[model samples]
Structure formats: C-alpha cells, structure tokens
Target: MTYLANPTRYSDMTYRRCGRSGLQLPALSLGLWHNFGGVDTFENYRAILHTAFDQGVTHLDLANNYGPPPGSAEENFGTILKKDFLPYRDELIISTKAGYTMWPGPYGDWGSKKYLVASLDQSLKRMGLEYVDIFYHHRPDPNTPLEETMAALDLIVRQGKALYVGISNYKAEETAQASAILKQLGTPCVIHQPKYSMFERWVEGGLLDTLEKEGIGCIPFSPLAQGLLTNKYLQGVPEDSRAAKPHGFLKTAMITPEKLEQIQQLNALAQERRQSLAQMALSWILKDPRVTSVLVGASRPAQLLDSLECLKNTNFSAEELEKIETILK
Candidate 1:
C-alpha cells in the first residue's frame, strides 16, 4: 500500500524551538526504545510511525542500544524510512544516541572518540541516513573525560554526520560542563534528554534550571513513569502489561500498593479533566515551560494516537497543581 502522509498533519499539534537552536520539535516525539526491535512485529511499529507523523509528531528518537539485541531498532526504522517516509524526510527530525555497550571489548562501549564515531557510523548505516538531525551522547561516562565526549560530538557535527548534538541522562552539573564545552567547540548543546515524570522528579531539583540557564532545551523520557502514570494499572497489573513482563524494565514488584493508590488518585483527576491518566501525566510534563518535548513509546498505533490527545489539554489550574503535588508527595 502507498503511504501518503496526512495533508493537514501540522494543524493540531504544536512545535517548540529546541533551546536557542533554529530547530523546533513536535511536543510529543515518538521514541523507539521498545517494541520496534527485530523481535517485534514490523507492521505494528510501522503503523505507529504512520499514526505519529499523521498527527504532527515529526520527531522520532532512537538509541544505538534500543533493541534487545542492540541496533535492530535503527535497522527496522531504516526500512520504514525507505518504504514510507522517504518523501517526508525533509519535514522530520530524526535523532539517535550512543554511549552504551554495543559490542565486546573496551573500545566498543562508553564515551570515547573511537567508540562514539564508530557507533554513529554503524547507526547511520543501520538507519540508512547520511546524517541524523540530532546525535546525542546517550549517557555520561565517569571514566572518560567530559571534554573527550563533548569533542567527539563536535567532531561528528563538523564531519556532517549530525546537524545538532545533545546529551542524555546527564545530571545538572554534568550537563552544565558538557554544554560549556560544546559551546566552546561551536556546536552548542541544543537539547538534554532526562528521565523525568511525576514519579521521578530528580530533574526538578536542579537539571531543569541548569538546562534553562545553559540555553539547552529539555525533552524528558519516561514521562509516564514506566506506565504507572497511565490508567492501565489503576485496577491492578494486567497480564499483558509491561509490569507483568519478566524481561522488561518495569517489574511487577515496583507496582506496590502505595503506587496503585497514587495511580488511582491521578486517574480520578484525569477523569475530571476529561482525559486519560496517560494523557494527564504527559500534560503534566508539558506544563513546564522548560520542557520542549516529551518522548513517548507506543506499542500500537491506537496507543500512539491516544497519547497525542495529551496535547489537546496541557494546562492545569493552581488548585489542580497543588492537588497533584500533594498526591505525588
């Protein structure tokens, strides 16, 4: 079947500028962290991608270590890009990251010029991209000098392997240092990806302030707190849910009684807002002016479509915010 994009795709969704960079990203960018691997159904993810773009989700995020076997997400994304998204390439913001163990031996992992450069080359080949819209160092490496990793990012940009550079999972202090180095290198760290949600508020302590000060846009991952913020577990864990899965990051044990209560309270609030628990959760993150985007993962096209509804109502009253804070605490 031919894959013609929605003509009015830009009508409903919103785009925010990434830091001080000329680039802007969709409020809800799709993340290929799970369920787009070689082990998953290709049609399923392809359909999700289609639905995402149709709703103005122009940014697609990926990591070199996304798949269970590693590198398969990029390969699958490559196939879909060639098949359905070749023409719409100019309208998309494609980004990927490195800085994890990809292969055997020391050179295959961490933040080094050799590892980052080689990993990105492999990533480009897998995605069939000449250059990604943004390339990120997936995490901070305590063992490696920060300058080396930042320099590697600058080098990739100079070589035209990436249009912009970013850092992920880095703390506030680390982010400030990295951003300073990138600024000196003339690359200017444009974005910061952090694990933040109602459940995980570490970024609120300092990261968000640092990013704003450094002129780096913030895009938070795990905005739903690994599905806890969603309505799926309000009743209890479902057999088919991520928490029920033995192999995934979300474990059954993490769904304690207290967590369920918080989920239920939040669900009640979501109902008042005429939104789903997931939608409200995402909206909570988007309510922060510092957040440029929120990266979400979807297992199905319907799920992705459901997530897009968050954009419809992201505002919360002062009372609502106080209630949410009380419940979270």
Candidate 2:
C-alpha cells in the first residue's frame, strides 16, 4: 500500500519552520546514514521508512557516500522513493549532500564547482529525484576556495536541482563566511547540520552563536551521541549496537570507565524526570532555541517512537539543568 494514503497516522508530530523560511520540517527527522545502507536487508529498510513516515518523520537526510559501498544508501533510498514516497513528494523534505570522498581521483570530492555539480547530478540520479528539497556541502573543503564552493552551491540552486542549500560540520567563522557568500549569490543558506548532544558541546562554543546571528537554522545529527546517550550501553557494550559495527564511528573504546560513570550519573537524572536516558538526551538538545530539529537514525520503528516521546516533556526546569551540569562536571 502507498504510504501517503495513511498520512493521518503521523499528525501528532510537531513541525517547525526551517530558520524563518516557509519550509516546515518535522521536529524529529529520520536519517539514512547507518541502518538503511545497502548491506541491510530490504525488509528492515522498508519497515524503517514506513514507520518513520507514519510516525510523523517527514524529512529524510542522506548523502552521496552513506553506504558501506558508498552511494548504495542513496540507491536504496531511491528505490523506496519510487516505490512508496513518490506520490507524497510534496509532503516530504528529502535532502542529499556531497563533499566527502565519493569517487577516486582529485576532483572526485570536496566543494569545487566540478565536484559539487557532478556530485549532485549523480546523487539526484541515484535517488531518482528531479529536485531535492535541500542540498548540502557535506563538509568544508579547506583546499577549495570558498568562492568556488559557494558558486557551485549557487549554480546547483539556480539549476533548479535543489530548493535550498545547507552546510554540515562547519565551524563558526566558516559558516558565517559561507552564509555571506550564499546570500550574495541570491541563494541564502537555510540550515547548518552539526553534531550536538550532551556528550558533544563543540557547537555551543561558537557555531550556534553565529547561526543565530545569521538567521540560519540548525539541525543536529548524532543527537543521541551515536547511541551513547541511549540506554543501550548502560551496563556495558551491547553486541548488536553501533559499537559492534566493524567500521562504526562510535568505538568500543569510547565506553571508558569514566564515560560509563558519567552516563550512570546522568541516568539517575533521567530516572528522576521519569524519562529514559535517550529521551532526556534528545530533549537536552531541543531546549536550545536555535535548534530547529534533531536528525536521528533508527534501526526499528519502536526506537523512533520512543525518541519522539521526548516531546511529551521537553521543559527543563532550572534545577534540572543544574543537576545535569553538575553531573557533567
């Protein structure tokens, strides 16, 4: 059955505008970085996509090299788009990115006119998309001139392949400078996808301040710290978690004794609030006004639903904040 026919199933999720723009994305958007890769079974992929849409996750984030084989995730998601999400295209905020190593050779990756344009073309073809809602430069290309990268992004927008443009993993000054260039080119940057969580506060140092100053939206990936903020590692490393994946970003060494103790302390605070550690971690990020949405990855429908439950109690009293800060220290 087509997924759009049951759109009402997701009516409960709140939608927020993308940085003063007219585009309204779901508060919690689904990302296809890990579980939806090519190596995963088709049944699990289909179920996650179906469950996400039904759970009010209208936005899906992807990149050119999301698969173990690179570009396979886009291909897999493209199949789902053709099979399930095509009819409801207008209701979805599908985004794909370029800027990482995708192909061999010098011009294969990074933010150059040659690479960005070619990457988007390949990404669109892979995803079977005529136009993606947002196109992001996956990361900053220090080697490439800012003008070249910005111009490439500008051209992508002008070519009508993307409605808006975004950047990821950019520092404060770089984001500010890129926003300036994008605006000058008549294609204003709309969002910044950064990594933020209780365990990751790098953005809080200055990146967020710059985003607020520039009127750009922020969507934080790894909001659960690659599942560390979740209960999956409470006792010890679980056999089926991201830590178990051979090439996983979250390593087993990350579960140091000190980190485990910190988690245990934070878990007590979560229990006090009558919420799971996962929900608390998500809510902690949402408390910041600059945060437009949280990008999350899920292996199952139940996990997605459980994360969304963070909305039920997002308010963090002064005392709660104090308790969390004390624990972090």
Candidate 3:
C-alpha cells in the first residue's frame, strides 16, 4: 500500500530560521544515524519516516558512515525515499555529511577537496537525488588546510550539487575560521551540528556564542545523550539496549552509578513538568534561541511522538532552570 502523508502536517510544529539564512527548519528534525540502516527492518524504518513527516519533521539528516556497514544507512534511506517520499521531495530538507573513515584510502577520508566531492557524489547516488539540501564536512580535518575544506564546500554549491554547506564536530574557533572562508567564497556556512545534551554541555562554553556572532544556525545531535536522558535505563540497561550492544557507540561504562543518580533526579523534575525525561531534555535544548533545531533519532514512531511532546511545554521557570542546573552540577 502506498503511504499518504497527513495534509495538516504543518499545523502544529514550529519552524525557525537557519541562523541568518532565509531557510527555515522544524524545531525537531529526524536523524538517520541509527535504526534506519540496512541491518534494521525496512518496515520499521518506513513507519518512523512516515510518522516524522506526518508530524511536520521536514528535515532528515544522514551521513556517509552512519550505518554499521558505513554507507548502508544512506542506501536504506534511498530505498524509502524512492518508495514513499518522492512526491514530497520539495517539502523536505535532506542533508548528509562526510569526513570520517568512509573508505580505506587517504582520498576516501578527511577534508580534502577530492574526498568531499567524491563522498557527496557517492551520497547523492545512494540517495537517488541530484542534490542535497545541505552537505557537511562531518568533522574538522586537523591536517587539511581550512581553505581546502571550505573551498570544497564552495565548489559543491557552485557545481549545483548542494544548496548549502555546513560543518560538524568543530570547536568555536574552527567554526569561526570555516565560516569566514565560506563567506569569502560567497557560500556561507549556514548550520553547525554538534553533540549537545545535559550530559554533554561542551557547546555551551563558547561554540554557541561563536555561532551567534557568525550568524550560523545550531542543530544539536545527542540531545538525549544517546538515550541516557530517557527512562529506559533508570531501572537498568536492558539486554537490547544500545549500551548492552558491544559494537554500539553507547558503552556500559558510560552509564555509571553517578550518571544514573543524576538521571533519576532529572527524571523527577521531568515528571513535575508533566513531560518525560527525553521530552524535557529536548525542550531544555530548545530553551535557547540559538538552537535552530534538535536532531532526534527514533527506533519507533511512538518514540518520535514522545519527543515531539516537548514542544507542548518548552517553558522553563527560573526555579526549574536553577533546579536543573543544581542537579546537573
């Protein structure tokens, strides 16, 4: 059966400007970093995608190395796109990244012009799209010249392969430098994707301030701290949990007793706010105007809906904020 998107999808969700750019993204965007890979069930993947779109999540984030097999996520997403989202292509903001160990050779990795251009070409082919809404250098290449990387992004836009360009996992100073170079090339850096959550507040130091000054949008990944901020682990790590999976990013050591104690306190506060711990964590990130969107990955449609509920009560009283800070401290 062909899936039909809900007509009133745009009614409830909020959209914010991407920094100073004219483009706007939904407050919540779907990320295909997990569960949409080739290893996962296609039926579940399709359901999650449909649910997210029906609820007005217009952006779908991807990367070259997202899947267990590196590029399998893009391939899986491509299959779904051709099947379901082809008609709604104009309504979506699809983005992907490169800059990790995608292949064995030196040209296959890093921030070289050769690598970025080739990676995006392969990405476009896999996704069955002529162009992506945004293409990102997955991380800063310490060895590559900033000019080389930024110039590659500029070339991509000029070649009509990507509408915009961005950087991920870059610090405040690197972002500033990259933004300047892209501006000089007449292709501004429109957004920055970083790891941010109550458990990971590194961006709060100076990166957010830098982005504000540079007029770049911020979209935080891991806003729920890889499910640590959720109630799923309060009792104990499940056998099927990411932490329990030996090869997954979330390790058992990360869920320390101290972390669980903090999560318990935070969960209590979330209950007072009438929101789940996951919802509150997302809402907390959006409390800042600097955040253009929160990138969330969901294994199921219900999980996506639960995260969406954060938008219902984004308000945080000074006391609540202080209490959260106290708990975090």
**Alpha-carbon local distance difference test for all models:** 0.94, 0.89, 0.95
Clash counts per candidate, in order, are 0, 0, 0
lDDT tens readout by residue for model 2, 157-264: 899999999999999999999999999999999999998999899998999999998989999999888888988888989898889878889999889988988898
Task: State the lDDT of candidate 3 residue by residue for 155-196, as single tens digits.
Answer: 999999999999999999999999999999999999999999
Once model 2 is optimally superposed onto the true structure by TM-score, how far is the C-alpha of residue 77 displaced, in angstroms?
1.0
Give the TM-score comparing model 2 with the true structure, all chains together: 0.97
Q: In model 3, state the lDDT of residue 178.
A: 95
Index of the highest-lDDT prediction: 3
Better of 2 and 3 by lDDT: 3
Mind giving the per-residue lDDT tens digits that candidate 1 earns over 1-329?
99999999999999998887898999999999999998999899999999999999999999999886699999999999999999999999999999889999998898999999999999999999999999999999989999999999999999999999999999999999999999999999999999999999999999999999988999999999998898789899999999998888899999999999999999999999999999999999999989999999999999998999889999999999999999988
Instruction: Tell me which residue pairs clash in candidate 3.
Output: none
Error of 3 at 99 (Å): 0.5
How far is 313's C-alpha from truth in model 2 (Å)?
A: 1.1
Give every collision pair in model 1.
Answer: none
